[model samples]
Target chain A: MSTTARRSRLHRQEHLTALAFVALPVIGFLLFTLYPMLFSVYASFTNWNGLTAPVFSGFDNYIAMVQDPYFLESMYNTFFLMLGIPIGLVISLALALAMNRKMRGSTFFRTIYYVPVISSIAAVAILWQWAFNGDFGLINQILALVGIDGPNWLQDTATVKPALIIMAIWKGLGFSMLLYLAALQSVPRHLYEAAALDGAGAWKQFRHITVPMVRPVTFFLVVTSVIGGSQVFVEINIMTPTGGPEFSSATIVWYIWQKAFDNLQMGYASAMSIVLGLMVFLITFIQFRLNRRNQFSID
Target chain B: MSSQRVLPSPPPLKPERNLPDRTSSRAASHTKTRTRPSNSERKHRLGNLIVTIVLSLGAVVMVAPLLWTFSTSLKTREGVFALPPQWIPDPFVWENYLRIWSAGPLLTGIQNSLIVACTVTIVGTLFSALAAFAFAKMRMPFKNVVFLSLLAALMVPFPTLMIPQFTMFASIGWVDTLLPLIVPFIFGNIIMIFFLRQYLNSVPDSIIEAARIDGASFLQIFFRLIFPIIKPAIAAQFILWFMAVWNDYLAPIIYLNSPEVQTLQLVIANFNAQYAIQTDYPLIMAASFVALLPVLIVFIVFQRQIIESIALTGSKG
Candidate 1:
């Protein structure tokens, strides 16, 4: 064969091999991810009960969701749970800033903070449930020492959401802190040196040099935490099996799980899922846009 | 021999050089001015002390729950609820650990969880690494489009597909089996692929070309050349994936209904329900701690690699 023809033949062979490399994952994606995503969207418009054929009842599930008090409560709880996001950002950012300096035992401190992030959600929920127990729990025992009374945390309507939020912030703290630390390390040392030469104090250096440089990492963390926070399930499921008093702790994802499996209302659950998914997508989109605008302003 | 001659030096050593340079540069700048011991230096030392104290307090708070769990596991039922809860059990009971063995299907749960998590991590990492190798090093038509569309999978939340996926798995009679959990993931995990691909991007293409010229096939090149280079990235991803699968509650609860096949998390949930009402705190804590053990071990062993992978995600993004 001519040199050109030989090269073309080699290219064809390489292309075929490349196709083989990706074949399994593409098939898996189509079956497990892509197909189900599309099917669930279709299911949302129906009234299937996971047993019979889904009858097309256009927008009924969506409409019912709007009027459904339980669904709305779950949505409210989900957003309320997201209250941890800002708190987590501030706390983790503070922890990250503190640990960013070349200090003694930073590694040990980082590991301790990260323990909860690595632990099973079931383990965390069970441990926290014990701590939040009304009568003989850790929190109440501490309150007693302070000469104050403590209400049942998971059992009370008002405290259940707060309990969940606190657990979430604790669980998520290490991850966000570590991400921020990474961003902190990557900040050019020269920038800090330059700032110091110009008489910038430590706080001023952190506020000016550190914050702006890590904004993208901060954006990433916010987007992920918001997405994750809204999906809180195992914690509530383990802590309060029945979604707590008056469903105060029923997050959107938790409700979706209950509706689908427990209530056998697959169609209704799919509708809620789509709505929740869209909300997440919209938030992520907005974050991306905001980040892009910030980048432009910086430039 | 020709391949070895054509190949450049390994890339892992570069980071070692970069590290010392970073520290020395900062040190050099710090020593640039040495007039007198300034007030700011004292203030900075004071600041460091404050940070240390604050961080130590936070660390204690972070660890207190786990320590409490372990402590409670060693206590009797009454000891768990004691006012000003005992930091140490007077007579530490080992019965809680022993009881978990005979307690409702805990052993089975551990066995099943180990099977599923181990299989998924080993197989999933292999497949993801293979696909990532192709994406990173090989010339393929529609590569960008294919990879980008696969990334779209990340946007679709788990709940959105839970119902139809359950139906699909049910139709195939995979509902109660571990197939639903293990099979889909063994093909490839997108997140793992994404990370490995990022790590692999730094690897030089010339080495791969040299290997190809020396008559190594695609699979051989991947296993021989690329796999060793990216082993650290794979180790990090393996532990993370193992933690995810081991800690997974929702999927196992949805799929595995039988006591014989349930995972550790499912059993722990059921155990908590059965015992919490009965106030069997020791048994509950023991079970929770047992379920947490493997992940804790993995995290402690591979902490640096895991942190690096996380850091890699932040920096690359």
Candidate 2:
């Protein structure tokens, strides 16, 4: 066969394979995800409980969310949830840096750190609820050894979000550690050698070489952490029902969940989703722009 | 080995030539060769040790809750809230586990969750892989545009789509059945397909051409050739899907209202409301522990594969 004819035949075969590949997900995307998304946008413009016919109400749902105390409280709680990002980042970075060194039981320790990430959220939340119990929880019991009193973690508004933040950090740190560890591993051996030859110490080497090399990973981690942090829902919902004492830990997602399900205000809930989505989008956009300006990539 | 052996000679060169008496020479060499332990070196080693300990401790803390739950389950109601909480039960109450087994709804929830989780994994995986294979290996028209649009669509959070998805099922009278719970996964998943596509792309095209020349059809080639190569990716996706379906609260909560069809998570959530209130903490803990065992097993078995899959996918992207 002529080469041109053979090339055209191969091209046709590749085209067929791609069609077969995309068929299922494209259909699903249209049916399950896309259609629902479009429908919710329409639903947001209406005033209706899920049971009744949705009456077009223009911007009333959006207007209501603006003044809604629950919305404001939920928004506040989201910021509190974001406390996990910094706490997690510091611990994870410390961890990644530490584990980057040659050490005993290195693989085992890495696996141990990652195990929590794989465990189910429900199991983790339930376990923490027990540990955070005011009267006989293990944490309080431990604190008592030092002659310090422990507060009612889940019951008190002041400490509820903080307690949840601690849990978030524990669960989330492993993932960021993985990202940072990968970046650390990618750092060139020659850079360290060069630094050592120049009489630069370990600190100087890390500052001048490792930090610059890992900046892209750090930026990616920060952006993702914000995105994940803002969507915190399950912990609050499971650990402290009724959104903790006086709804103190009532994150936006939990409220959205409640409004849509418990309150049957789908339209209003959709508005909340839109706002949260926009907030996440804006934060992500700004981070990307900053990263571009900084020209951080070593690639 | 010889090259590394030769590498350290320069550092020890000056001190070794100065010694005459054996004992004095040994002491002299020790003094001269012991370079200053820089702050960074100490910090670096200390930091590594600290991280290992802290991570290990964190893992212990992570499992502490599960341990407590397990302990409570094995204890009597009296021991559930004991002061300075007992670390273990003396007799190891095998009865709590047995009681959980005997509990009718609990069993139903287990069966339902398993069915849903397994179904979601198998069907979701196959279809998603098929879609991903096409996306990765095939060169159909408008490929980049189509794939980009799909990625963009990921931004639409499920909360925004819940009402309509629920209503669509309800109008079709599919709300009460497991169909609502399991059917949507039949199509390719966004994350899974994307991942599979990434993996499939790394597969050398020459292999596919070799299969093509053997006179295999598309289905044959996919099943016989590509499937084995992507086993690791499939295993990773399977574990992820299992967790997703098993831990899923929102979808199952919306879809399955009947006690008979309720999943384990929904059952656990409803334990207080329906099964028991003023609850037996020991029993609840026992039930919760039982609920967690499978997920932990999945993680243990597939952790390496999962990590490899992530590294593989992340690199391709």
Candidate 3:
């Protein structure tokens, strides 16, 4: 064979091998995920009780969601959970900064914080349920020490979401901390040194050097936390069986679950699911746009 | 991904070399005459000490709930809810651990969880790997469209499909069986497939060319060459899928109706509510802790591999 022919044959063979590697995942995604997603969009328009065949009912479920008190309550509850994202990001960054120093037992601290990340949400929920139990719980005991009586946390309308938020922070902080720690480590020492040489104080150095360097990481965490926060189901499902007092803690996913499972409102549930997906996607899209703007300024 | 953020090493400061300033002569003279720590050094030392103490205390706070769960499981019923919530369960009720064996339907639930998790992990990894390989290497037309579509799959939000999937499974009369839990594993998971595909794309094209020159088929190249190289990626996906399926509650709740098909999550959720008459709080907590053992074991065993893979993958993600 000519040299050119030999090289071309080898190149073709490599391309063929590449082709083989990507085949199965493509087919699977088409069959499972994409198909189901498309299926969901179509299903949202139909009146189906999961058992019966889906019937065409144009815009009814969507129209119903506009007026549905339960859906509105769930939306409110979802935004309530989202409040934790900013608080969580700041607290996690603070924790990460504290740990980033060459302190003794740093690994021990990282591992300690990360324990909750791996823990089952069900386990965390049950544990929190006990801790937030109205009468004999630990939070109440602590409250009593401070000369304040605590309400039935999970059952009280005012306290339920806050209690869940506290648990969410406790459950969530470790993962965010790990992400921040990674971001913090990536920051160059020269930047800090340059700031120090310029007579910048520690706070100023952190504000100018550390924060800008880790902006991408911060953006990533905030976006993801919002996504995860909106789908807050297992925590509520386990901790507050009735979805908290007066349905205050029933977030979007949890509400959809109740509709589909308890009320057998499959059509309505599917519509709610679409709305939730759009909300998450929109938030993420906004975040990415905002991230690009931040990156542009930083660069 | 965090590991990639290596800071540039600053030049080491020598006391004499960098002390060319007017302030240094006075500072040097003051320090040279004294063995006692200066106020600034004392403050620095104090600051360091404070940070160390605070960080460690934060660690304790972070881990306290886990410790609480563990220690409380060892306590007697009275001790479990004691007013001052005993940090130390003196004369620990060893029966709490022992009674878990006698706990109702726990053994069955454990078996069910293990079967589902194992099946999900093994099958999910295989399917995902196969799909990932196809996406990474196969030369089909319209590949990017398919790949982008697959990426889009990650955003569908899982709950959106739960009702429909349940309905679909119910139509096939698979809802009550382990089929709903296991069948999807055969189809493949989007997240795992994406992870594998990304890692496989990083594998150099030259190795596959070498295999193909010897007249190896696509399947052979995949099984022998591609698979071996991506073991780290596979192990990473394995741990993730294992944890996910093991901890999954929503699916099992929706699909598995019978006691025979119940997952560990469902069992734990219903442990106090269902088996309340038979076992008390300590026993329930003990069983709960026992249920957590497999996850802990998996975490400890693959913790290093998982963490490194996450660090690597998180950068690209």
Candidate 4:
């Protein structure tokens, strides 16, 4: 074959080969994600139980969803859990900054802090269930020592969200801190040195050099946290199986699962699922736009 | 779809780009640092000492719960409810550890988990890497469109699809088996694909071009050349994917109703529900801890790499 002709043949072969390589995942996505998503969108508008064929009811489930107090309350609970993210991020950044210094035992401490992150949620949730036991649990015992009596944490409407928040922060600290630590490491040392030479104080150097460098990590953390946070089910399921005292700790995913699997309200649950997806996607989109504006101003 | 949220935005603010005074100022700072070395050295030492002490206390809080779980796993029933709440399980009962194997389906749970995690990660990773290699280096028609569409899959949360997916699996009679867990995942993980593709982008095209010119086929080039180059990235991603699969709870609970088929998470959760009513705290704690041991071991062994990979990707993510 002529060289040009052979080159053209190779190019055609590469195209086919690449498509063949990618075909599996594309097939998987179609079968699992896209197909299921389209099914869910249709299911949301129907009134079918899992056993029966769907009968289209035209926005009835979505209408009922807006008026459903349980749905609203669970969503609020999910949002309340979100309060932990900023608190966790702040503490994580501080921890990472502290660890970034020339200090001994940093590796030891990193591992120590990361223990909770690596722990399975089911295991940790079970552990925390015991820790928050009304009388003899770890938290109350410690509180009693300080002359402050702790409530039945997981059982109280007032304290249940806080309890979940505290645990969420503890579990997530290491992961975000590790990310922040990585972000801090990447800020060129010369940049910090330069900032210092320019009469930028420690706080100023931190504001300028550290914050922007870690903003991407922070943005990444918040976005992931929201997505993870929105689907907060395992901990709630394990810790407060009845969805906390008076349904205070019930999250959207927990509610959806209960409706579909337990109550057999498949169509309604599917509608709620659609709403949750929209909310997550919308929030993420807003974050990206906000982030872009921040980027514009910084530049 | 969970993987799509974090955009692989390269770290935006490289100071040298916008900070025109940075390099020259750094040189001046270096000379100035030499004149006041002792003064700054003392401050650094003091700062390190303070940070060390503060960090230690924080580490205690971080680790206390796991230590507490371990301690509780060794305690007698009443010892758990003792007024002081023993920090150490004095006169430890080693029986809970022994008894956990017989309690419910803990053994089978681990077996099922291992079967699922191993199958999904081992098989899934190969497909992910191949797709990644194709996406990264190979010439294909409409390549970017295909890649972006796959990425767009990440936007759809699992919760959104769980019911339909449940019905889909059920329609095929795959429910109550590990196949539901393993089959859907064996295709490839988009996140892993995205990361591996990013890792491969750093390699020059000349290498792949030279291999191609030598008449190496695509699969051969991937196995002999690309795979070795991307092995470290694959290793890190493999560990992450393995941990994710091993620790999965939601989907397993949705499908596996029979204890024999349940993953370790479900088994432990069942233990929590059943044993808690009887106040079998130690037994529950023991099972939960055992459920955690595999991932704990993996994390400790691969701590540096896992941490670094997550950090590297998080910034880019």
Tens-digit lDDT string for candidate 4 (A229-264): 999999999999999988999999999999999998
DockQ each candidate and list the results.
Answer: 0.69, 0.43, 0.45, 0.60
Candidates in order have lDDT scores of 0.87, 0.75, 0.75, 0.88
Q: Whole-model lDDT for model 2 versus the true structure? A: 0.75
DockQ of 4: 0.60
lDDT per residue as tens, model 1, A163-217: 8888889898999998898888778878988999999998999888888999988
Error of 4 at A240 (Å): 0.8
Model 4 whole-model lDDT (C-alpha atoms): 0.88
Docking quality tier of candidate 1? medium
Model 2 alpha-carbon miss at residue B253, Å:
1.9
Ranking by DockQ: 1, 4, 3, 2
Sorted by TM-score (best first), the order is: 1, 4, 3, 2
Q: Where does model 4 exceed 4 Å of error?
A: A1-4, B1-35
- lDDT tens per residue, model 2, B151-223: 8667666666777888889888998788888888767578887777766766777666666666666677678
User: On residues B11-45, what C-alpha lDDT tens digit does candidate 4 reach at each position?
Assistant: 33121122224346547655765688788978877
Q: What is the lDDT of residue B133 in candidate 3?
A: 79
| 10 residues in a row with least lDDT, candidate 3 chain A | A17-26
State candidate 3's DockQ.
0.45
lDDT of 2 by residue, A16-68 (tens): 77686688778888898888877787888998788889999999999998899
Candidate number that wins on TM-score, 2 or 4: 4
User: Which of the predicted structures, 3 or 4, would earn the higher lDDT when compared with the native?
Assistant: 4
